[model samples]
Target: MLKHLKEKKDVGFFTSIAGLMNSCSVLDLDAFERTQKAEGLGVGSEGTAGEKNMHDADFTCALFRFLQLLCEGHNLEFQNYLRTQAGNTTTVNVVISTVDYLLRLQESIMDFYWHYSSKEVIDQPGKDNFCRAITVAKQVFNTLTEFIQGPCSLNQQALAHSRLWDAVGGFLFLFAHMQDKLSKNSSQLDLLKELLQLQQEMVIMMLSMLEGNVMNGTIGKQMVDTLVESASNVELILRFFDMFLKLKELTSSSSFQEIDSKNSGWITPKDFQKAMEQQKIYNPDEITFLMSCCEPNMDDLIDYREFTERFHNPAKDIGFNLAVLLTNLSEHMPNDPRLQRFLETASSVLNYFEQFLGRIEIMGEQKEIFADFHSK
Candidate 1:
């Protein structure tokens, strides 16, 4: 441990840390770990302004002093010569400790600043050191990771830090993304649509491990508080309620009233399957249904299999789609204070039939009947 501290090579650092970690002598690290577990302290968001320290400032100061004293005992021959050169070994010790603390502190600073800023926000305090922070943080993580995994390693301790960093980083990025959106001036429909659409894109990019992890806890009560305060200010329920009403009427009147123009809405399941065999180019009618649904990502719904199977939509899937749309639109509507304002305002009703979709599917030569919704 002493040899590595003297040379401070990557291998040496890890060897030293590993040795200490297994033996469990670090008092500050132990307390910090316990605090995180007991408090359920969430991963800090990337978008937050100015950092709250990752460790107690007082504790850190004490730990640094302890480390210096502990390392002072190692490499006596080098220390003696250094003391003679300095006229006092204690003065040399102060300089070395100061340099070591500064170096580690710089790494910590870099990590905090890096991911928060882009090329644009460099002048911003949180963003100014973005690139420098990233570079420094990466180096620290790499060095620390090696140290933690060394033959005398503290692998568990290191793993805990890594996990905490990722959780905090992930939540921060998510926050920064949302802050970018919410801080803008837009209508509720625009904001909700934007957030929903954003989720569709970002959520799928996450690894399954992230989803399975306790990362959910990272969205703390403060986030929920912000959502309630800012997002709830816009009311969209009446628009959605009216939309739902029109959609409820969208089904065939003959089916709804049991009086057909010799027509039934249900196509045979076979013909429906045939239409799905067609490529993603849409006929006009399919476009209209999606527009009416107000599905912002309707263009990207193919992964749901409903894109091709629209003609195959039994009442069951139709019901499911209705539910999803209705639920999505109606959510948070009740939470908005603007609901009363909307109710007091104008009456709106539109019978929507748009087939403006950019994509559609068709089953080849098989003779299959498609639902009327597929027919333009």
Candidate 2:
């Protein structure tokens, strides 16, 4: 059956298979055990003529192979089926558990510290293994986000699911652990940045879920506790701020003066706009939001030092601070080597804090903008 499915080139066939897989009932382990005992079958036993001679391992391999085929050339159909299933409670739960499994497996094989260690002996095969693990991690994360944002949009049940929160926590922890591993590698940095954006989207969906649940008074205390615990990890927060401060250093140097003629240690909105355009990374909405956060005057000038002071303090609108960091990482020029390095490092840091604030805001804690700032 696996070989037949793999050889088939028809899109409809793949779609049908995907739909069937999605709609299938969950595995009945009790029935399977009963059947095994009745048949007196060993792990390698050949079944009767009417029944297929397959063990659990064979079934697992075939299932994965079918999924691989669906993913490889029939992604649209696969995604369509997933979209259809996104709203189903059972399907959402299955996706969450599957993603968690993949993440845990990847984590087991890819040693965060060892992968980045200078003293570790890393050959070509080892590097390939790291690449493969990161790719799997990315796939799992992307799948989770799609379920949250697409099929499961505003799905309170899915959002409140402990497995979903646990998977996200695991993802964030892995990202934090692997930060230093991607430092000197630009390609890996790009991948990391993409992962961060996906993480941000997932957080946004989770927040929407929280809002709905809060209004309905159905938000689980355990979910809230998980979010708060994940958000308040001090080491992660410090690491995030450390990269943020480093990225700020780039703006203080004389290089940016070439772009900002006023050079009054500040850049006006107009100037910032032009720089963003030159970099070909400008987004109007992001620029507007960033300008609002910095509180530019009639002259539209953004004072770097003042902006820094405002953004660095969590007490002053944690959401806005996150928006600033995200905007900076997204809009900064990647072609310029120095700026690219700074942006990549900033991206890694922003990744964690975005998740942090996203989780915290879900609990209704960090949404307000304060007039007075308290230094942390």
Candidate 3:
């Protein structure tokens, strides 16, 4: 029937299939299990001779195949139909809900396989069942990927017009979660390879959308805005770096030469903690977490080179530093009204500038504006 519909190329027939596909939503496994139990159809329940037996695995396989058929042909027509359906909130909800459900199902299967395969003695039947489960889960993932990527594959039209980024983000998050889960089990190397390939493809697609052709300034403007935002908080971050430099000087001085002799420019956690306390900067908890993240091996020493590297390449430790700063700022708010007001005003002004930049970036022929702005 699907092939016939495909061959006929009837709009209504394909639209109906796309609508059905969009209607697919994530299943509530817990509720489903509860209902199954109420109906005397538990996970491993079997019917007597001459009676019909229903299994969750069977139902899952059937659903998987159905979805696979919906996405089998790189069906651009169906994808276009879905793009139209996306205008309806209910349809979008259904699509997202379904994707979420499939991701959860895939995660559950991977978790089960990882757990069972790690055991010393694995049941043959159980392992086979899990292998089949993994296959079904992969099918579910591929079906969704094909559906989302099919339209976006046509240059960047679908990417610009549809909520492709949202879909990409959702799938990326799920894939990351799956990757983490599989990382623990050494047996899932093949799955990990496939996941890495998918991640690379998704990232390339996202870059294509952002960068586009040579004439496109979207990515350049985005980079500029990011730089501006990062610079906005530079003063606070610089103060932290300055404190680090001061501490480095203190620890490297003759007074602490004995301690420095052991690690040759690396300072012990105790010394680092004391320095932070002297600076009255980070709290005890923040200091502890920072020490752990920086050291990571309980080596009892923080490398001076490594510490400075984080400043040069701020991406490495910026999140931790920002989080610590925010926590400290919040703690001091009650006692430091003036500091709070100053921060609030600065944040407001920076936000206004960000909005202004966004508007300027969106304007056509921004070259003249940029040239004029830069000349001033």
Off by over 4 Å in 2: 1-93, 109-124, 150-155, 184-211, 215-224, 231-238, 253-376
Misplaced by over 4 Å in model 1 are 1-127, 148-153, 161-376
Q: What tens digits encode model 3's per-residue C-alpha lDDT throughout 113-160?
A: 454445543343333433444454455555555555433333244433
Per-candidate Cα lDDT values, in order, are: 0.30, 0.43, 0.42
Query: What is the total number of backbone clashes in candidate 1?
Result: 26
Task: Return the candidate ranking by lDDT, descending.
Answer: 2, 3, 1
Report the candidate with higher lDDT, 1 versus 3: 3
RMSD of each: 22.7, 18.2, 14.0
Q: Which run of 10 residues does model 2 get worst, by summed lDDT?
A: 367-376
Candidate 1 structure, TM-score to reference: 0.20
Indicate the residue-level lDDT of 271 in model 3: 76
Count of clashing residue pairs in every prediction: 26, 0, 2
Which residue pairs show collisions in model 3?
26-97, 26-98
**Per-residue lDDT of candidate 2, residues 1-376 (tens digit):** 4335334533454455445434322222334334456555554534431132112323333443444444443244353443334333333233444444554544443353343456323333334434444444444444444444322323345445546666556655655544434432434544444444444444444443333232213333443344345653424533444533433444554555686666677777676556544543334653443444454657766676665553344322333343443333223222334433333544644543554443222222244321211112
Once fitted onto the true fold, the runs of candidate 3 whose alpha carbons sit more than 4 angstroms away are 1-9, 23-27, 31-155, 187-194, 197-201, 204-376
Candidate 1 weakest ten by summed lDDT = 207-216
Model 1 has an lDDT value of: 0.30
